[model samples]
Target: MDLLRKSIERVTPLTNEEWKLIVEKSKRIQLKKGEFLQTQHSFVVYECFVLTGSFKTYIMGENGTETVIFFTFGNEWICDLNAFYHKKQASYNIRALEDSELVVVTKPAKDVLFSKIPKLVNFHIHMIEKANIVLQQRVLDLMNKTSKERYVDFIEKNSGRLQKVNNKNLSSYLGISQEFLSKIKREGEVYNEKAR
Candidate 1:
């Protein structure tokens, strides 16, 4: 709950009363690796704040292929925004990549909080803006960047995830074949060794 408070505080200061209200309304949940936090066809009733570990959100295609959309880590929020906002069923799945803890606020609880503390609305807006920017950048990268360029960009921007995330998942997220990703990684290692 303190972590949840800190994450909200990063966006807006909350009064003691507001903090108390939030703590009362949110619930803590734990999930192990391979667990599904939210699956397709379910209603997205809560928005989750990751307290520890990581998660991946993806959609399954008609051909049964899973396309990785994004990864959310500790200190980040994960939800099917459109479904949550529109009161529709989720079109994607969110699954735990590792053993994870999350603080979740239900839609009703969040609405009540917004009504009581209007300023907290800005915090949600800021989160949405950040998510949008990242989504846009990812779309652009996938469309315009070569596989190797995409891999390099991922290494530069998400170095912290390199060791935590497996090659298959990373390659899928980067829209590259696993074989190509391995080749790129091997070549990168060779280049670094020669530079040393």
Candidate 2:
């Protein structure tokens, strides 16, 4: 509930009544590591606010390789927004990286909320815009950044995630081979030693 209050504050402080309504409408769920929040091809009926832990949203290619597109920690929103908006099947799989607690608002419930609280519209737009910018940066990095550079960037952007997640998942997300990631790590160590 404290996390929910924080989340509301982030979106533009909710009124006491609004907060009460949100609490009434929303449900908190616990997710285990590797648990799916939304599966690929399933309709995303709810948008989740992460209360604790981290998650990765990924897409599986035809060749069966999984490419991670986004990461979210506590206080972040994680959902297939377009799918939820359009009431269509989700394109990505959102999985919890560790045990997590999430506040979930269903699409119908959100619609009711927006009608009651107009400020939510602005919050939704802001979230969408932020996600778009992140996607644009990710695309540019994929095109222009080398594997080593991407690895470094990943480490920089997701320092906590790098510590918690396995190297294999990190390698896949960075679009590099496990061997290549290992080599980059070794090279990084050497570079640090030389700098020292």
What C-alpha lDDT, on a 0 to 100 scale, does residue 118 get in candidate 1?
Answer: 95
lDDT of 1: 0.88
All candidates' lDDT scores? 0.88, 0.86
* TM-score, cand. 1 vs. native: 0.96
Least lDDT summed over 10 consecutive residues: which range in candidate 1?
A: 155-164
TM-score of each: 0.96, 0.93
Across residues 31-76, which tens digit of lDDT does each residue of candidate 2 receive? Answer: 9999989889988657888889889889989999898877788888
Q: What is the C-alpha RMSD of each candidate to the true structure, in Å?
A: 1.2, 1.5
Worst 10 residues of 2 by lDDT: 157-166
- Regions more than 4 Å wrong, model 2: none
- Give the number of the best model, judged by TM-score: 1
